[model samples]
Target: MKVIIAEKPSVAKNIADALKIKSKKDGYFEGEGYFITWAFGHLLQLYDAKDYDSKMARWKMENFPFIPEQFQYKVKSDPRNRDRQDGGAAKQLRTIKSLIKKREVDGIISACDFDREGQIIGDTIIENINAGKRVYRLLLNEWTPNAILQGLNQLKSNEELLPLRNAGVSRQWADWVIGINLTSAATLKFQKGKGQALNIGRVLLPTLKIIYDRDKEIENFKPEKFFKLAALFRTKDGKEYEGFYTEGKEDKFKTKEYLDNISGQLNGAPAIVDDKTTEKKRELPPYLFNLSNLQGYITSKYKGWTSSKVLKTAQSLYEKKYITYPRTASNVLDDSLTGKAAKVLEVMKKGLPFEEEVRFRKSKRVFNSAKVDSHSAIMPTYLVPKSLTRDEAIVYEAVKNRFIMQFMPAAEHEETKIITKLRNADMKGFFVSKGRVQLTEGWKKVENIKSKEALLPSVNVNDEVETVKNKVSSHETKPPKPHTEKTLLKVMETCGRSYNEEDTTAEAMEAVLSGFSIGTPATRAETIKKLTDTGYISALGKNLQCTDLGRRLVETFPVKELFDLEFTGRLEKSLADIEKQKFDKERFLQLIYQFTKEAVQQIKTGEDVIIHEIASSKRSTEVLGKCPVCGNGVIEGFKGFGCSNWKNGCKFVVWKNDKFLATLRKKPTKTMVKQLLTKGSANVKGLTSKKGNKFNAILKYEKNPENDYFSWKMEFDKKF
Candidate 1:
C-alpha cells in the first residue's frame, strides 16, 4: 500500500475524489491500494523563547538577540492533552511513523501543495519520522482527476527541490528570531512597568511602518501655491472646447509675477488651434485573479473585506471544487491548460455577468501557460457552488468573473487627440482639441464592465463650435491625504516606491513588494488589532488617528528611519534575498537584533528630549493665573497650575490625557460640587475625571476678563 500525505483535509478529500477513492476510513480515505491523510495548518511550530531557556522567558537586553544555536520544533497541545504533554503533532507523527514501518507499506507520496511552505511541511515530517522509504513529490496543478492522474504518471524526485526546502526553513527561522527578539525587547524597554505588549515582526513592523509613514507624509506636508491656466474656445460646430494654456517651461505657475503675467495675457483671449492627432487602440481583458490582485480590488472597490478574508473565501471555494487553486501567484495559465478553459467556462455560463463574452472569441485572451507557476489563478472547475455565505459569494463571483473574462476578446477602442496653434497669442501657446472612440457601448460586446469603462464624445478640429460658458475656478494646493487601508496596501506591495506598471524599476520592486507586504494575509488582521489595543491608534469610524501615546512614540523616533520609504525599500530587498536563497539568514537576524538593541538604548537614555507642555496655548491668559493651592503658580490652559519658577520640583498634572478632556458635554451645577476639603472647586459641567467618572462641580473662580485670568473659589450660584 502507498500512503499520500496532504497539506489539509480539504486537499486530501479533493485528491481522494480525483483518484476514485469511494471508501473513507477514520483518519483517511482508502481505495485503489492507496491511503491518504491530511494535516491542519502547520501542526508543528518552532519552539518559543522559554523553550530555548527558562531565563530567556523574562525579556532583557542580554537575553534578547536570542540566537538559538539550533532551532527546535514542538507540537501544539490542547485542553484534552491534560495528562499527555506529547502534543497533537507528536502523536500524529508517531502514528504516521508506525504506519510507515508496516510490512504492507511500500513507499510514501508527498502530495502536499506545490509551494515552498508545502515542501517544508513534507520534508520536516519525513525527517522527524526517520522514514527511509522511497518518497516522491506529486505535482498536481489542479485537483481534478485528470490532472491528478497525469501528475502521478510524471512524478518527480523530491531531491531536486533542495533549494526550495532550504529557502522555506530559512524563512521560518528568520521570522521567528526577528519577531520574538524585537517584540520582546521593544515591549519590555518602551512599555516598562505598564507591561504593554507591542508585537513586532519582520513583516509587521515594515507593514505598520508603511501606515505610520503615510500618516507622517500627510502630517508634515505643507501645500505650496501653483496655478494652472484653462482656455475655452469654440469649434466651427458650435461645441465648446476647453484648452489648457501651454508653456514651454512653466508647467507649474510658481512665482507671483509669473502667475500675474500669464493671468493677464490668457484671461479673455480667443485660444488658438494648434494640432490634431488620433489613434485606434485595444484594451485587453485583464489577466485572471491572483489572490493579491483580487484582494486589492475588493478592498479598494468594495471596502471592509481584507486580503485575508478574500483568500479564506477563495480557498473554501477551491476545496469545494467550485474553483481551481486559490493560493497561486500566476495570473495566466499554461498553454496546455488553456485548451481546458472552454469546458470550465461552459459550467460557469449560466449566471456570470460576462456569459456572452465567454461564448465569444476566447482563443486570444484565455489562459497562457507562460504565466503559470505550480498553479494557475483561480477559475471555476466542473463543480458548481449551490450555496455560499455573503462574503464567500462575493469572492466567488469575483474569481468566477475573472476566469470567464480572461477567455473573451480584447476590448477595443479609438483614442483621439486634436491640437491647434493660436498664432503668437503667447510663446508656445496653443488651443487643443480632443475626441475619442465613437462607440461607448462596444466594450460591452466583450464584457459588461461599467465602473472602469470610459465614455467619450466624437469631435473634429474643423467642426464649428461656440463657447457657451466661461468660468475660472479657484483651487488651492492640497496636502497629501492620510493613509487609508487601500493606499497602504498599494504602498506595501510596491515597498513604498512609485512607478508605472510596466516600468523596470516598478517590476524590480514586485517580488519584494508582494512578498513583504506589511504582513502575511494570516497575520495582518491581528497586527492591526495590536496597534489599537496599545492605545497607539484609534478609529473614528473607518478613519484612524494617532493617540497621544501613539503620536509621542512616533515623535520619539528619528523622522527619517520612521517615515522614509527608502528604509522599507532596503529592508524589503534583504527579505527578497532570503526568498531567492542568496542572503544568509544569520546576518539578517543580526541586523534586526542590533536595531532593537539600539532603539532600546536610545529610549533608556532620554537624550535630546522635547517636552509638550499641558497648556493648550500661550495665548490663554486665564490659564496663566496664580494657583490657589500652590500659591506660587499660574492656572495653565486646559489643566492645573504651572509653576512660575522654571527650575523647581513642580511635576503636577491634574487633567486626564488630551483625548478624554476633548469630549465634554455640559456645565456643572452647585449640587454637583463637593471638592473644597481637598482642593479648589469649580462648577464645570460634563467634565469627566481621569477615572472616566462624569460629574458637575461647584468651585469658586475670580475672572479678570481684561487679562483672561481665573482663580478658583469655593462658592457658586444657581444661575448665571
Candidate 2:
C-alpha cells in the first residue's frame, strides 16, 4: 500500500479520484493499494516564547530576547479551522506511522501545493513521522487531474528540496524573534494599562513605517508659492495649443519685473517653432498576474475587495484547478505553454471584450520561459466559473483575460513629435511638441485602447500658428495627502526593495528595479492587514493616518538602528542566501537574536524624549481661573490652559470660550465662569436665563482679551 498526503482535503479528494481510489474511509480514501489523507494547513508550528521558559510568560525586561536553543515543533490543531480538534493530526500521523512500521507502504508521496510554505509543511511532516520508507514528492503546480497525473510520473526524492526547508525554518525563526520581542517591549512601554498590543513583524513594521512616515510628511509640510505662464494658440485644424513659460535658468527671472521685461519682448511678437521628432513602437500585453499585482489591480479598479480577499479567492480557484497555482512570483508565461494559448483564448472568446481581441499568434513578450518560475501566473484551464463573488469574478476576469490576450499580436502605434523656434527680437530659442497615432490596436483591443485616451498629435517641424489666447496662472505648492491603500502598498514594495543590496546581476537588478516588492504574492495582503490591526496605524476613509503613539515610536527609535532601509535590504539578502544555501541557518538565527538584544537595550535605556502630542486639546499653557464647582483652587497649566482644580488630582478642565459663533448663531455664546461668578448665572443663547429661574438677564461683556467684565440686563424674550 502507498500513502499519499495532500495539503488540504479538497486536493486529497481530487488526487483520490485521479488515482482510482474509490473506497472512502472515515478520514481518508483507500483502495487499490493506496491511502490518501490530508493536513488542515499547518499540523505543526514552532514553540511559542512561553514554551521556552515560564519566565517569558509575563514579559519582563530581565528576561529579554528569549532565543530558544533548539527549535522544536509539536503536533497541534490548526488555529484557523476551529470546528474540530479530534486529534485528527495525531491520528493521521499514527496512520502513516502504522503504515511505515508495518512496511506495507512501499513509498510515501507528498502531493502538496508548489510553494515555499507547502514545501515546509510536507517536509516537516515527513521528518516528524520518521517515515523510514523511500520518500518522494510530486511537484503539483496546479490542481487539475492531468497536472496531478503528470506530476506523479515525475516524483522527485525529498532530499532534493533540503534548501527550501532551511529557508522556511529561517524565515519562521526570524519573524518570531523580531515580532515577539519588539511587540512586547512597545506594548509595555507605550500602552500603559490600556493593554493595546502593538504587533511588530519583519513585514509589518516596514508597512507601518511607510504610513507613519507619510503622515509626518503631511503634518510638517509647508506650502510653497509659484507661477506659470501659458501662451494659447489655435491651429488650422482647429486644435488648441497652450505654450508654457520656458525661460531657462540662465534667463534669471526671479521677479515680476524680470517676467515683465520678457513679456514686453513678446507682447505682439510672432512665436517661432523649433524641432519635431517621432518614433513608432508597440506595447505588448501586460505581464501576467502575480498575486500582489492582482490584489493591487483589483483594489484600485474595484474598491470593494482588499489584497487578502483576492488572495483567498485566488487560492480557492487554484485548489479547484480552475487556474494554475496562484502564488507564483513570475509574471511570465511558460514558453512550452505558448501552444496552449489558443485553447485559453478560445475559452475567452465567448466573453465580450476578449472575444473581439483574441488572436492565434503568440507575442514574444508574453511567452518568455525565462520569466516563468514554477507554473505560470494563474490562467483559466478552459473552465469558466459560473458562481463567483464579485471580487472573485473580477480577479478571474483579470487573470483569464491576460492569458487570452498574451497570444494576441502586439499593440501597434505611430508616435510623432514637432519642434519649432520661438524667436525674440534679439535671440532665438527652441520649443518641442509630440503625439501618437495608432496603426493597429492588436492586443490593445482586449482592453479597448480606442475609447481609452492616447496622447495628442504633433505638428510638422516648420508648422507655425498664431497665438490665439494666453494667460498666466499663479499656484501654491500643497502638502502631501495621507496614504491611501494604493499608495501604502507601493511604499511597502519600494521600502523593502530600498534595502536590497545584492550585486547588480541582471535578475537582482531587475528584482530591485521592478521595485515590484518583497513578501510573496500570497503574503503581502496579510502583511498590510496586520499593520492596521496593530495600533501603529488608524484608518480614515481609505487613507491610513498615523496616530501620536505610532509617530512617537518611529521618531523616538534610533533611525539608523531601527528604521534603516539598508538594514532591511541586508536582511532580505540574508533570507535569499538562506534559500540558496550560502549561509548557515543556525548562525543566521543567532545573528537575529544578537541584533534584537541590542535593539531592546536601546529601547529600554535610550533617553531620547518624544513629546507626545495631546489629541483634542491644542493649548500650550494654562492661566488662573476659579473652579466652577469648588470656588477655591485656581486652574494652572502650560499653553494658557489648565484644570479647574489646582491640587488633589481632580480632572476637571476648561477652555476660554471664543465668540465666533455669535454671527452664525445670531446669539451670544455664554461663558461657564460667568454662570458661576454672579449668582452662578450667565446669559446664554442671546435671550437670557438666570440660576434657579430667578431672573431673565443677558450678560454683556466689555470684550477684551484681558480686563473683560460683564453686566446683566434683565429682560424677557418679547421685551427685546
What residue runs in model 2 are displaced by over 4 Å at the alpha carbon?
20-22, 77-103, 235-240, 245-279, 334-343, 346-364, 372-375, 419-435, 450-464, 477-484, 490-509, 512-518, 558-562, 608-720
lDDT of 2 by residue, 1-720 (tens): 778888999899989887777898766788777788887777877777777787787888677767788888777744434333437677876765665555677888888766668888887787888867888888865777777778887889978877767867787778888878877775555444433465556666556677777777888898775655555655557676655555442322235554554445555456555565667788767767766566666776774466777788888887777887887656667787776666766766885654654566655656777656455766787666777766567778788777766766788777765543455455333333446678878776666657233465345555666566545556677888887666665445444443322122465435533333445555678877765554466654456777666676676654234465446646755665666678788788888898888877766776645323233444333334455445554333332133445444343433232222211222332243434344444444442122222233444322233432232333335452
What digit string (tens of lDDT, one per residue) describes model 1 on residues 1-720? 988888888888888988889888666788887888776656666777888889986667667567787888766544333223445566666666776777888888888777667888888787777778888888765677777788888888888766567657766776676667656655655554433355555555455555566578778888787665565666555556665544653445565565455556654454434445667776656667665567666766664555556667777776676777776655666667655776777776776564565563435335455435446666777667778877878888777767765555556666656554443345555444445553333334443565343332345554433333333334568876665454555565556553222222535335533454444333445455566655666644334556666665566533235344556555555654665667766686667556655654554454444322222344333433344435455434233334444234343333322222233333232222223222454455655554677766455544445544443443335672
Model number with the top lDDT: 2
TM-score of each: 0.71, 0.74
Query: Positional deviation of 255 in candidate 1, in angstroms?
Result: 7.6
Q: Which ten residues in a row have the lowest lDDT in candidate 2?
A: 657-666
Which 10-residue window of candidate 1 scores lowest in summed lDDT? Answer: 669-678
